[model samples]
Target chain A: MTDALKPGATIGILGGGQLGRMLSVAASRLGFKTHIFDPGANPPAGQVADQVTTAGYEDSAALLAFANAVDVVTYEFENIPTAALDIIESHGPIRPSREALRISQDRLTEKTFLQSLDLHIAPFADITDAASLEAALAEIGTPAILKTRRFGYDGKGQARIMSPDQADEALNAMAGAPSVLEGFVNFSHEVSVIAARGITGEVACYDPGENVHRDGILHTTTVPARLSASQRMDAVLLAAKVLNALDYVGVLGVELFVTPQGLVVNEIAPRVHNSGHWTQNGCAVDQFEQHIRAVAGWPLGDGQRHSDVVMENLIGDDMDRLPELAKERDCALHLYGKAEAKPGRKMAHVNRITRPQK
Target chain B: MTDALKPGATIGILGGGQLGRMLSVAASRLGFKTHIFDPGANPPAGQVADQVTTAGYEDSAALLAFANAVDVVTYEFENIPTAALDIIESHGPIRPSREALRISQDRLTEKTFLQSLDLHIAPFADITDAASLEAALAEIGTPAILKTRRFGYDGKGQARIMSPDQADEALNAMAGAPSVLEGFVNFSHEVSVIAARGITGEVACYDPGENVHRDGILHTTTVPARLSASQRMDAVLLAAKVLNALDYVGVLGVELFVTPQGLVVNEIAPRVHNSGHWTQNGCAVDQFEQHIRAVAGWPLGDGQRHSDVVMENLIGDDMDRLPELAKERDCALHLYGKAEAKPGRKMAHVNRITRPQK
Candidate 1:
C-alpha cells in the first residue's frame, strides 16, 4: 500500500511563505513529502520541506519539472501568477480548480459571484478612471475605501477616501490600475470561518473565531468567540454554502463582518488565512492538516473545539519573548524563519488554550 | 533577534529517527538549519534534516566536523553512545548532558539515579549473564522482564522471562548484552509527562496524557487524562525533579506507570517521546515547539492543553485512511513519510479532539 502512495508522495507547493511552511509540515506528518516551488530566495517553506525549486513562476520548464515530481499541486497564496498554474495544471491535479483562483483574484468578479449567489457582501462599484471614480463615489458614497481588484494584501494596494477632496489622490495612487470602491461595513466585530472541502464534495468547518486587527493586519483570533449559538450556526451554514457554490477543494477562509443585523460576508480567501491560527493550538485538526486532508482526497477528521482558544501574532521584534513564553504550561509558539523583521511583517504566533467549559 | 543566529545556524541532533524529522520541521519553522549525525543509512531523521553525517559512534573526525558546523546540539534518543557524546561535548554543547544520557542508557543506572533523587522506579536489577539471570529470577520471581542495557526502542531489546528453565534462552536472546531484569509492574494505567527546560533552566510542562500501547508500541494518547488534580501535580513535580537532577536541557519525556499505590517511574526518554503527540493536536504548546525553544536558547511558551483529546497512530497500511480522516471537522492527522510500511512500523498518526463541557 505504501509503494503506490505511502507518504513518499511528493506534494508540490506553489508560493513560499509561512503558510506554505506550515502546510509542508502538516503534509510531512501524514507521510507525504513536500516539494516547494517559489521564486523567493530562501523561502521559509523551503527550509523544512524535502526539496526546493527556486524558479520564477513564468518558467515553464521549471514548472513542468516540479509538476512531474509531484502527485498533486496546492498553493499558499492566491495571487500566484496565472502562467504558473497553467503549466502545473497541465502536468498534475490542482485543488480548488483554476476557476476558483481566477474568481478570487479579481474583486469585481468575486463580488459579482457572491451577489449572483444571493449572498451578503458590501455594496461596491468598479472604477476605471476619473469619471468612473466620481460616478462610483457618488453611488457608494464618501468615507469609502478604494482597493485594486488584484494584488492586495496586509493593508497594501488600498487607500481610503475620507472625503471628496481625497478621492483624486486615492485614484492617482493606484497608477491607473482597475479598482473597486467599497462602502465600509458598520460591524461591531470581525470573525472568520475556516472551512475545507474535499474533492469528493465533503465540507468541514471550524467554529468561527473572533478576530482583532491592528493597522490592518490580524493581531489575534479567539475561538468559542463571543457569539450566540445561533450566530455561530449561521456562520457555518454560510461558509458551507460558499464552498458548495465554488465546488471548492482545500481550505478556504471567509472573513465575516458581524453586525447587529447578522453575519455578512466580507471576503473569501481560497487559501488558508491568518484568522485560523487558533486551530493549530485549540482543535484536533489545525487548518494546515485540514487543507492537506481536503486536497489529498482523504476523509476529514472531526473539527470540534475542545477548549476556549486564543491565538495572537508575534509581529516584528516581539519574537524576543519566546523564552518567557515557552515557560507557560500551555502555549504553542510558531516563528517563521523570516530573516528580516521589517515593521508590519508577521513573524510568528502563540496560542493559549483553555479547558472547554463543561 | 533572529539575526543573532542567521539561517545557517547549525543545529546538532543526537538521535536519528522520525522524531528528528519532526524536530527538523520545528527548527526550519524558526529559520535555523540542522546537521544530523546518525550511524544508520536509512535513518528517518536524516531524510528531512538539512545535513546528514553517517559514521560510527567512535569516528572522531566526523564528530569534529559535525560539532564545528553546528551552533547548538540536541538529540532524539536517550541512549546516545557515550563516546559520541564525548566527541560532541569537546566541540559544542551536548544537550541533556552526557550524565543524563549515560544514566538513562542503562535501566539500572537510571533507577538508581531516580532513587537517589527521592524519585521512585519499578524494582530492577543488573543482569550480566546466565547466572545473574538465574539469581534475578530467583529474587524477582517469574514474569520479570529483561531489557538490554542500551539501544532499545519499540518492542526491540526486551523479553519477558517467565520460567526458570528459560533463563539460559533469555540470556542467549539478549545476545550477551548487559541487561536489566525488571519486576513486572502491577499498574492500573500508563501515562507520560512531557516537559522542556531552556538553557536558562526555565521549565514548561503540558498536562499529562493517559496512554495505551499495543505490541509494546504506542497506540493512542489522550489529554486531560483521568487523574486527580494532585496526581497531575505529582507527575509534573516528578518530571521537574528528574530534569533538574540530570541537569537536562531541551525536551524530555518521563513515562509513569500509574498504580493503586501511586506513581512509578516507567522510564525516561532523554528526547521527545511518542506519547507527546497529543500536544500536536490538542494543546497550544506542542512538544516539538518546546524542544526548539530549549535548543534555541529562547524563552519557552505556554504548554496548555485546550481540548480533551485522543491521538491515534497510523501503522503499516494505515496510511491509506488519510483521506477519510481529513474529512473529520477537528481531526489532526500526521503521517511520517516512511517509504515502506513494513508490519509494526510507525507510518503516521491522527488526533481527535472533544470540546470542553461549557
Candidate 2:
C-alpha cells in the first residue's frame, strides 16, 4: 500500500468524542475503517467505528494492542500522555506528528513557537509561583488571563484578572501548576482558518470563519468572515507557514484575533476544530475527510466553499429546539449521540446554508 | 419513545451493502445508532454500524433478536423474505411497511400497482408459462423485455427480444419462473425522482436526476435533469402519488422514462436507489439522511438541490482510476469498503460538483 493507505485500512483514533465520530464517518466515506480508543464506554465514535478499545491512555498494554491493530494512529484531541504516545509511535506513525502535539499541548510552548515564526501574538509571560506571577503581571498588565500552561480547554483552569486587586484570586485559579499570563488582545472579532498539509508537503486552507464564543465555548461560526482581502490571504499564508515549520500532516485549526493592526494568533489546535464544522455542508470535501486524506497519504482535496453557512453549536438545552431545527429549510443537523446533554456540553450542531456563495 | 425514535435509539437495517453503509452513517448524524443484519460476514455497513447480526433471514432466532434490539427496522433492499419480515414485524414495526415491499418485490405486481394509479406505464403482461408467454408476445409485440417477476436488478434476470423470433429464447431465459413481458418505451432519456414521505404523511421530493446506464447498471446521474418545469412538476407529483398510495414511510426512488407523450413509470424502489446518489452532494439533506429521518419518525427535511452535481459510479476496474479522481477538483469520493471489486460490482462513486445551481 506504500505510504498511502488503501481502502479498508483501519485508522485508530484516540478520542471517541464528536470529532472522532465525524472523523470515523469521513474515513468510512474514503473506504477506510476506524477503531476508536477511549476510556468512556460506548463513546460517541464507538457507535460508528468498526472497533472500540475501552481503555484509558495510561494502560500501556491496551495502547500497544490498539496501535498494533490499525494501519496508523491519529487523535481527535491533544493532551495525550507522553508514554501512551511513545508506545503508539514505537509501533506506528501518528499524523500531525508528535512535535505539533508537544508544541500545542502547552500554552508557553505554543505562544513561543508562534512568536518565533514572526506571527502576531498576544503579549504573554510565564508564571511559576507567586513571585513570578507578580512579576509577569507587572510586565503583561492587569487586564489579562492567567491560565495553566497545560491541560486547559474551554475556559477551564484559567481565571480573568480584571484588575490589579484580582491578581491573588486569579493566580490561585492555577492551583500551583505552571501557568502563562497573557495580555488580552483588543480585537474586533475572532476568526479561524482550518488548514491541512499532506504527506507530500502540499497545503490547503478553507476560508476563514468568523467565530462567536459564549462562556469560552464556540457558539457559532459563519464563513466569509469579515476579513479584508489581504487578511484572508495572510491567514492562509500564515497557516501554510505553520504547517511547513512543523512538517505537519493532517488538519490544524488556527484561531486568530482580528485587530486593526493585524491578525493575532490566539491559539492553534493540531486536529479538527469546532469552527470548521461549517465545511460539512459548505464544501464538497470537508475538514474531516481532508484530515483523513492527509494522514493516509492521499492527495489533498480542494477546500473551497460552495455555500455560505452559519454553524451554531447545540449546547445543553439546545436539544429542546431540535424539533424546530429538523424542519428548518436548508438546515443540516449533526447530532452527537450523547446519552445526556449536560450544561455547556456540545450535544449537536446545525449548519444553516444561507446561500450558494461559489 | 413514541412513534418517533429518540436520539441513541437503534435502527435495524437489512442488507448491509453500500446503501446500508451510507444509511448507517446518516443515522449516526441524526444521533441514532444502527444495527445491521446481513447474512454476509463483515458486511460493509457492519464496519460503521453500532452492532451487527450476521445471520441469514431464515434464522428465526437471529431475526427475533435483531427486531427486539432495534427501535424501528428499515431495509436497503425490498426483496426481504416474507417469513423473515413476519418475524421482525411480530417483534417491532418496519418502516415503508410490508405493502410497499410486496408491491415492489415483483415486476408483475409493481407494474400492476403502478397502472392501477392511472400512471402511464409501458404495456406489460404476466407470463406464467410458454402459452402465457406467447399470448403476452402477441399483445406486447416484439422489441420487448422478458424479466423475472422476482429478484431482478441491474439488468439481471431479464432478456431482451429485438424480434418475434427471439421470444422463445427470451422466455427460456426466465427458466420457468413467473415472468413479465413489457414493451419498451420510446423515451428520450431516463430520470428518477428520489422522494420521501414522513410519518405524518408529508411528502418531499428532490429534483429529478437524469440517469445513464451501462451494461444495465447505473453509470451516472446528473441533477437538474433535462425536464421542463411542467415535467418536473409531473415527476414530483407522480412520486408523491406513489408514496401516498402505499402509505409509505422513508425514501422511495421512482424511475421514469421521459417519453414524448408524457413521463412513463418504469419502476419504483421501496428504498433508496443508485440513481439518487447525486443528492448526497447536491442537497442540504441527502436521500440517506431523509430516509433515516422518515423511518425514525422525524419531519421530512427540505429536499431542494443547492448545487449542480454529476455522480458517476466506480465499477470493477474503475477503481484503478481512484488516484486521478481523488485529485479532481470539486469531486467527493464515496467508496464501499468491499474486499474485492469483481466485474460489474459497484466499488464506489464520485460526485463532481459542476456548479452551484441554486
Candidate 3:
C-alpha cells in the first residue's frame, strides 16, 4: 500500500494477443512501459510495446530476464501454465494471484468455490472415472455439458450429453481424464461483469453486459443490459466477492448465466475479457486501463458506463463490415491487423453507441 | 481509391507534441508505420515512431528524404512552413491538401476562406505597420484581440487591446509583423468540431465539444455541448465546408464561437486537436484513427459520441491528479509519459463519462 507505481516502470505481461496489444496501450497511457514475454515470435502485443521477449514459457533463463526487466508482472490470458507462473512469481509480483488462476482453471474447483459463497451455480458434478461419469450424467440428466477440468475455451475440449447413453461417449472422448458435468439451465440470457480489485483491497465493478455467443465464440456484448436491478446487483456483488476472495489485484471478468430465478456463476476470467470491449468507447477508463492500474499498485478506476453500447466481435469475414459498420451513425469499428480473416478467427470488432434516453 | 496505404508511409506531422505522439500510436495500430520529421529529436511523437528526421523547415534534402520514404504524408499541425511543404509535395501526396493548411495557417486567410463559402466569421481586419494598425483598430476597435498573423497558440504570440495607447504597445509587441485585428464578439460559449473528409469526398464529424480555456491553454472539452440544434448543425457543416474546400483527406478541428447570433467560425486546425480529446473515450474511432484512415484512402469512420463526456486537459500541476483520477469512478485519464510537467506544458488529459440515463 505504501508503494505507488512510478513512471518508466516496466510491466511484464504473459501472452501476446489483441488483449495484450490493448493492455500495452493502456500501460503506456499511464506512463508505465511494458515488457511482453510470449512464446510466439510475433505476438500482437509486441508491435507497440517497449520491448518483447520471444522465448518459450518453459525457458527459465528468458523468463528470468523478463521478470527482472519489469516492476510488475501480469497476464492477458489465463491458460499460462503453473510452471510459468512459478518462474515469474519467484521474481516480480504477479497480480490476480496464482490462487485465483488455480481455482478458475479447473471447472470442479471453480464450481466448488462458487457453492461455498452461497451463490447460484449451474448444477454440476465431478467425473473422475467412467463410473462417476455415468452417476453424474444420471443425476444431472440429458443435454448436460461434459467439459475437461482444464485448458478449454472457445468451445474446445468439451462435449455435451443429450442422453444417458451419450455419457460413455463423452467420458471416452476426454480420454478418461477428469471432467465436469453441467446440467443445462434454461437461462434467459448470458451476462458478464468485468471488475477489478486493487492492492489495497478496493474493488470496482462495471455494469453487467448482455453477451450473445455464436458457434462458441462471443458475437456481441451490449452494456446496460436489460436486467432487473436485483440481477445487476447480484452480478456485481459476485464479481467483487470473487476478487476479494482470491485477493486479486487486477481486472477479472465473471461470466454469469441469468435464469428466471437469479444469476448463476458460469466461469471467471482472471484477466480482461472480450465482453468488456464496449468500455473502450462507453466508459471513462477501459478495462485494459483498469487492469493496469490495479497491478501497478494504483487506485482502481470508476467502472461507470457513460453511454449505452453494443460491442460486436468481428470474427473472420465479419470484418468485411468495416465500411458498413463505420457508416452506421454512431458505430465504432476496431480491426486488429491479423493477416488473414480465416473462418472462426477473431479478426476485429465493432462498437455501436446509442443514447439511452435520460 | 482501392489502394490502401502501405507500411513505411510518411506521416508528415506539422506540430511535434503529445497529440502527434498519440497519432503515431494510431498509425502503427493499423500496421502503417510513420516517419516523424519534426525539427527536434526526442519529440513525444518521435519516441514511438519508426523513424524521425531532424531538420529545419527550409531544408529540402531532409524533407525530400522523408517524403520519398513514405507513399503519402499527413501533417499533425496546420502552420507548416510553406517552404517545407513545397519540397514534400514534390515527393509524396500530401493528404488534407496544402490548400487546407494555407487557409488555416493564418487568421485573416481563414476568415476570408470561410466568408467565401458564405459562412459567418468574426469581423476582422489585417494590420501590417503603424498606420494600418490605427485604422484597423478603429474598424475592429478596442476590447478586441490583436493576434500575430502567424505562430500563435495557448494564448501566446498575441496581445489584448483595451484602449488607444494599448494598441501601440500591442502592435509593437508583435515585433512589427503582420497581424489580424479581430473584433471580440461577446459569446455565451465556445466549442469545436473534429471531423474528417475521405478521399471520396465523404465527411464524418464527431459530436461538438464545449471548450473552456485557462491562460490560453485548453482546459476542458465536454461532449454533447450545450448548443442549440441549429448551432450544432452549423458548426459541423462549417467544418465539412472547410474540409471540402481543401479536398482534405484527414482529421481537422474547427473551433467556433457560439455567439448570440449563431455559431461563427473561430479557427481551424489542419490536424488532430487538444479540444477533441473526448473522442478517445466517447467515440469508437478516435480522431487519430479517423485521420489515419482518411489519409490512407480508407473509408472514414463513424465520428459519433457513444456517451456524454468531459475531457479535462492535465496541464502542469494538473497531471498530479493521475492517482486520484485513476481511482475516480468512470474517469478515463490519459497521460503523455512526459518526464516532467513543466508549467504550461500539456502532460495528459482525463475524460469523465456521463452516460445518458435510461
Candidate 4:
C-alpha cells in the first residue's frame, strides 16, 4: 500500500468544473493544495484552486509540469483521454486507476464487466454498424435506449427505440459512432450509492439516495432513500464489490434501478457524483472530502448519514431563484461560479436539511 | 441600507490568514469570487481565493487596484491601519464599517463601547504614561491586566499585575505604548457568541461556546456551553446589542466572562473568531459562510446549533496527532495550508461531533 500523504502536499486535479471546485475546497480543508489543470480559462475550479494551468490535454509540456509539481493526480471526470493518462501516470500515481475509467467510458464495456461479475444489469447488446444495430434490436426488442459508447452525458448522445419501426431512426441518430442498445428496466425509482475505497483496501459506502430526473438531467436527490433494510445492505455490498474488483482508490458513484425483483446496476461514475451532494449537509464528512482522503491514501471517514437532506440542482434559468433560495432557512447553497447561465448548465445547487425533525 | 449583492460579485479580503482562507471558501460556495490582499507571499487565503495581491496595506496603488477589482471590501483582521481604510473605502464599501474596527481595535474603546450599551464590563482605565499607569493601577487595584491598546492578539502585549510592588515592572512592559488596565473578573469560565448582522439590519447569534485556554492560547471550544436557559438568552441578546449598536454588517465574536452577577463583556472581534470554529461542524451555516452572507447583504441563516461539537485547535507540534485524528470517526478537520508548524502557531483544528449521542 502507498503511504498516506502528509499535510501541505500538492494534489493535481485534472478538470475545472464544479466537482473540481468542491474537491479543491475539500483538499484545502485537509491542508493539501490543489493545482487545477483544464483548458478552459477561468473555470470554476480555478477560482478556488491553489494553481491553474489553462492547457489542453495534448499539451505534453504542461501536463509534465503539472505532474511534477504534485504528489498525486486525480480527475474530476471520467472522460480523460488515454493519451493524457499515459503522460500523467509517468510522473505520479493516479487514483481510481485508468482501468476503471476505460470501462466506465464505454457503455458496452461497462455492461460486459458488470455482467461478468454476475451483477444484475439491464439487457444490453453492442451495435457497431447498421447490421449489428438491427440484430441487437431484434434481441433486445422495443423500449430500448441506443446510446453512444463514449462521451455521453446529461441525456446527450442517446435515442429511445419505442418500437421496431423506429430502429432505422435510432440507428441514424448514432451518427456512425459505436453504440449500445439497453433494454429498459421498469424501475419504481432510481437510487445511487456513493462509495469510497482507500489505498489500504478499506471500503465505505454512504446510504443510498433516491434520485429524480427531468429531461434526462438530475433534478433532486433525497437521502435516506425509501429502501428495505435488506435492500440497503445489498446496494452497499454491490458497490463494494465493484470498487474492490477495480482496485479503486477514491469515491465512486454507483447508480442503480430499484425494481420489484431487486436493485439492478445501471452504471458507475469513478468520481464524486451529483446524487452524493446531499452528503455535504447530511453527513459529518462529505463525499468531496471522502474522495480527497481516499486519493491521498488516508483512512476513509464515516459515511453515516446524520441528517435527512434533499439536494436540488439549479439548472439553466434556475439562477433567477437565487434571491429566494438565499433566504431559505436550513438551506445550504453551493454555486459553481459559472460566468453564464446557459440552458441545461448546472449553475448551482441547494441542500435542504429536513431531518432531526427540527 | 445597501442593496444585497448578487452571486458572481467579487469581494476583496484584507489579511490572507486562516480566517480569510475560510471566508474565501465560503464566498466561492455563494457563487462569489474573492481577491485576497496581504503583504505575505502565498498566504493561506491565496490558496483558495480567485486572486491574490501580495502588497502591503500601505501600498496605495495596489490597495486601490484591489478595491476597484471587487464589489466590496472586508477584512479578517482588525488591525488594518486607518490610512489604508481611507484608500480602500474610497474605492469600495468596507463591511463591519470603519466604526466597528475603531471600537474593537483598541481595548480601551471596546470597553467603553460595551459600557455605553449598558452591558456589564470589567472596570478599566486608560494608561498613556507612567503617571497614568500608576493612577489607573490605584483605581483598578492589584490582580489586573495591563494590555496594549491596539495590535495585541493571543495574549501578546499583556502583563499581569498581581501585586503593587510589580507596578513598575508591568508599566515598563508597556514600553511607552498606550495601554489599558483592566481589573480582573472573578469569573467561572469564558464563553463566546458568534453573531451576524445583515445589510438590512437583521441580526442573528449562534449559541455560546465555552472556551479553554492553554498557554494563553485557545485550546478548545465546546458548543452548548454550560448555561441556564436565561443565561443563554442573555448572551445572545448582549451580542445582538453590540452588533446593532455598531450597525455591523458581518460576523462578530463577542467574548464574555460568566461571573456570579451576570455576563461581562470581555471584548469583541470584528470578524469570525477562533471560538466560532465549532460552527463549521455544528451548524448548517458556519461562521465563515454567515459572515459572507451578511457582507453580501443576504438574509441571515439559522444559527441554531444542530450538533454538540468540541473544536480543538492543533497548535504547533500538535500536527503530530493528525494521523490519529484522520482515523477518528465523527471528526471534521480544517487545516490552514501553512508550510511550517512553528511554535504557538495555529496550524489547524478539528471539530469532533459528540452529537445525536452517537
| DockQ of structure 1 | 0.54
Docking level of model 3: acceptable
* Residue-level lDDT tens digits of model 4 in A33-98: 999999999999999999999999999999999999999999999999899999999988998899
Report how far off residue B12 is in candidate 2 (Å).
0.5
The TM-scores of all predictions, comma-separated, are 0.91, 0.99, 0.89, 0.98
> Arrange candidates by lDDT, highest first: which order?
2, 4, 3, 1
Per-residue lDDT tens digits of candidate 3, residues B150-172? 88888887898888688889988
lDDT of 2: 0.94
* lDDT at position A296, candidate 1: 74
Highest DockQ scorer: 2
Measured by TM-score, the strongest candidate is 2
- Local error of candidate 3 at residue A13 (angstroms): 1.8
Residues B1-358 of candidate 2: C-alpha lDDT, one tens digit per residue: 1467889899999999999999999999999999999999999999999999999999999999999999999999989999999999998899989999999999998999999999999999988887888888888887889999999999999999898788888888888889999998899999999999999999999989999999999999998899999999999999999999999999999999999999999999999999989988888899999999999999988798889999999999999998889999999999999999999999999999988967
Candidate 1 scores an iRMS of 3.9
Residue-pair clashes per candidate: 54, 0, 5, 0
Against the true structure, whose lDDT is highest?
Answer: 2
Task: Report the lDDT tens digits of candidate 3 across residue range A256-335.
Answer: 98888888888988899999988877776789988998998988777766677889898888766655554666676655
